[model samples]
Target chain A: MKYSGIKVLWEGLRGNMGWKPLWRNPDPKKSYDIIIVGGGGHGLATAYYLAEKFKITNIAVVEKGWLGSGNIGRNTTIIRSNYLLPQNQPFYELSLKLWENLEQELNYNSMVSQRGVLNIFHSDNQRDAFVRRGNAMLMSGADASLLGVNDLKKMVPFLDFQNSRFPIKGGLWQPRGGTVRHDAVAWGYAKEADSRGVDIIENCEATNFLVKNGRCYGIETTKGVIKSKKVGVCVAGSSSQVMGKIGINLPIESHVLQAFVSEGLKPVIPGVITFGAGHFYVSQSNKGGLVFGGDIDGYNSYAQRGNLPVIEDVCEGGVALMPMVGRARLLRIWGGIMDMSMDGSPIIDKTNIKNLYFNGGWCYGGFKATPASGFCYAHLLATGTSHHDAKDFLFNRFEKGRLIDEKGQGNQPNLH
Target chain B: MLIDHPLLGLRDSSEFIYMGDAKLLNRPNWKSKNSKTKFIDYGYLRKNPGGVHKELWYHEQGDRSWLVVTRNTVTHEILKVELARYLKRKENAK
Candidate 1:
């Protein structure tokens, strides 16, 4: 009877209500304190933070399907605080700290591995840029070390330092940045939130919002109308659609990002390795599979399947870094939808709608920022103001022309 | 559409008179590891505004973009110079 967040998540996953209703709750009608759309990391994290931090237990996190069964579960699971912009660095650092204590805090096994993270530099200009970024990280109380080629070789011995297109150069190393179990994070948060009295509704899609007098009063879902005084649109990819119901057109684009897992082999990659010169990053999952992902699909698509171009690109990048992996068979490759913003950051704030809030536009870096996002959103809800730490990510930045374009690439793909 | 070099933070757009293996532009002297890179020299301006400008751009960084240069169409000279060198003159404060 003590339906906790983890318990409820497990039930929903196991089809406690059964598979049919989990995917298709034909007559969805209900009301609760808050209706969070999309059961991904943002949605689940928002619910967890609202209940645990704000003590607002009447919240209902409605998912189109099972939790973490979307982008939340399909990301590279990288956690780092190496942002050049002052606005993003602190928020991400908070998330990094949260990740360090996640296993204990959530009372769940998230398998958070802070082995380390390396961003290899291939040019002097890149080296200069990363030097500045590393300095910024240190200024913000985060750890970042600039290492030379010898440092890199010592850290990752198996790397093909001798013969490579972009030979081994120094790198920016964050001892704390690493990977976590993507699915476990989603499930852990959902379970913890549910146990804390938050309603974790799965297979219950948020079809629309019920706005009265220009304020969101509740949501119209496949399950029916869920009444609530406040609502949070935590959906990432479907942000435009969900916000459209309330007449808000988010300056967000839906792009596809793909990742692949190689068959289990003896773990070669100790920590997360990212080619500063290429769109590739790899981390060995606890289960021994090498989980790797890189740049967007070059085109937009709601379809979940990936194309050969990115796969080939990612493989080539992988092989270029670690030749041994060239022999490992790719077990499976999948894709997820990312709500890429005009700038490659996130938007977590109260929407133009009075009580409707948002925590979206994570791009490819959602997993790492989940905890910080939830923390800041909860702070906003509890204090009735934007967290001082997150003023840069305001939803109106686009119109205000104050976009925090970190990479200065002026494109979304460069944001991550 | 012409784009900036994918990994290199610069642009040059011209038909690559010749393709050469990339080489890394920077490596600390204290390190013994190989720092190689590659690049293509097209005879046109690759629209990479936030990148370095050079006739020959080694894509030391990844994130495919455009690269522009002045290539001898007849001779197919890959080592051609960039015309933008003259514009380096600082703008006068009128």
Candidate 2:
């Protein structure tokens, strides 16, 4: 049913019984031209774009669980294109533009909020670095502004600006970067793709691939085997394990990153804020709860829960940045496994196996890259070429030693 | 999480710094014929198993020695801990 303000009133008067399921639960078909392995945001968005733009509709998205079960629902819901490297900036900028028109395109409210993101700098060297990054963002066709100390004090007065330990000097602001309702992204894409004749098979786990002479022709699922001409696997943290079935060992390791939310309170934070001296970031949600998170758990794990040491470290950063948050009680905390790549960047390229593609190694930045990931991956699968924006996410960069180490943190996946 | 340190007894995980998969214990030889490809695999590809994992940890705040700790990735349960000095770097290493 088409939804509008009038529909709400109509449903209210008609006793609210006209609502229907968001997407149909379809059985696995015998064959599809293309099969997306994981039905998360990227998978659903790939299906959506392939039908809407590339005109390829014989597609099937197989999910092991329901929608909103993965990182799409588990992220802290922040979005930004504030990257420094040229290899990353343009791709994320494209995703940010897509996020701008996403609701109208999908006919669903994903709540894309461009409330602005602020990265406070604690030292003069960091200030210079922010200036360089802000310049790079502008050079890559994205909006950025370096704010002075006075502007920051006027903007977020709750910050501990006068602290002697790590005084907040200034900040880099991106007015077009903010948060979006993350899971709604999955639902919007799923609904639109399903409506456009793409089948989404939930609760169907892909166990193995049917590969002969290195060309993947089908997938073996729990339900049954289904043939496909092309197979693209973008299963985030599970990338290593899923592709392991085909004897492909990726340059990616899985690590758990935790996110937290506080009990609902009156509006205090205006937009997203990052503590420069520590690894903490926070933004107030639409429901008045403060959503925040810090670094990864620094180990290899598949568990969706985390230990308390990272929790205490996150709280310390929060308290150091905004003393008011120390009083707010913690409500919920969850973990998502990150496909931490060797160089701390993502890879979206065709593998050595013909007709079998890979798109993962997203680390903790997958949520923000969802839209562009789908768009570029669709372009590659449909046209058999890399999108101009995603040309640098090649699998052979390690062999060439052309590492796009954004943080320059070396080969440590957990640090990224 | 508590690490059952072989020498230090039970200690909080915060005292130790985590290094990834203990598979790194097998460092590729720089003098081999296929060392280039082997180093790429050594520096990059990993099993990243979802079940049992043997990883390395440094007692940075205590004994300052590296230890190989076998733990379940799914349950975070420590099964065993041994000093890294006692383990062979590679099966053929002298």
Candidate 1: regions farther than 4 A off: A1-30, A411-416, B1-94
> What's model 2's lDDT at A263?
96
- Worst lDDT run of 10 residues, candidate 2 chain A, spans A1-10
lDDT of 2 by residue, A270-361 (tens): 99999999999999999999999999989899998899999999999999999999899999999999999998999999999899898999
Q: Model 1 over residues B1-94: C-alpha lDDT tens digits?
A: 1223333423432212212111112112433333111111111102211112233332323332223343322222334332222323222222
Model 1 per-residue lDDT tens digits across residues A211-312: 777788988877778898788778786776677665665656566789899999886788999877678999988888999988776433456665576688
| True lDDT of residue A16, candidate 2 | 94
TM-score of chain A of each: 0.91, 0.99
Give the winner by DockQ.
2
lDDT of 2: 0.93
Tell me the lDDT of model 1 at A210.
80
**Which candidate number would show the highest TM-score if scored against the true structure?**
2
